[model samples]
Target: MSACSVFDRIFMAGLVEMNLSFASKYGAKALGR
Candidate 1:
């Protein structure tokens, strides 16, 4: 594949990971309360 495609995949992965982290952090706090 191309470099751009590789970068996009990495970017998307980071984005998903960040979202999951944010969601889990907030979700746990919300549930705890």
Candidate 2:
């Protein structure tokens, strides 16, 4: 695979991880309320 494609995959993975963490935090706050 090309370096550019590999970098793009890593970037997408990072975004997905960030979104998952953000969602979990929001869910926890909602539950607390």
Candidate 3:
């Protein structure tokens, strides 16, 4: 139970980092264009 929650939090942190990086890349590209 507790271990599953810990895994879930780590997974969500990775997901958030991915999303932020993706958005940042697209935003920079859009500005460059």
Candidate 4:
């Protein structure tokens, strides 16, 4: 695999993790206390 592809995957994973954390934080409030 190329280094660019590896970096892209890591970047994407980081974004996904951030999004999941964001969603969990706000979604919990939107859904309920």
- List clashing residue pairs in candidate 3: none
lDDT of 4 by residue, 6-27 (tens): 9999999999999999999999
Evaluate model 2: give its TM-score: 0.83
Ranking by lDDT: 4, 1, 2, 3
Clashes of 3: 0
Preferred candidate (lDDT higher): 2 or 4: 4
The most accurate candidate by TM-score is: 1
Collision pairs in model 2 = none
Stretches of candidate 2 off by over 4 Å are: none
Candidate 3 per-residue lDDT over residues 1-33, each given as its tens digit: 699999999999999999999999999999995
The global Cα lDDT (0 to 1) of model 3 is 0.96
Q: Each prediction's Cα lDDT score?
A: 0.98, 0.97, 0.96, 0.98
Q: Of the pair 3 and 4, which is ahead by TM-score?
A: 4
- Total backbone collisions, model 1: 0
Q: What's the lDDT for residue 26 in model 1?
A: 98
> How many clashing pairs per prediction, in order?
0, 0, 0, 0
Cα lDDT, model 2, residue 8: 100
Better of 1 and 2 by TM-score: 1
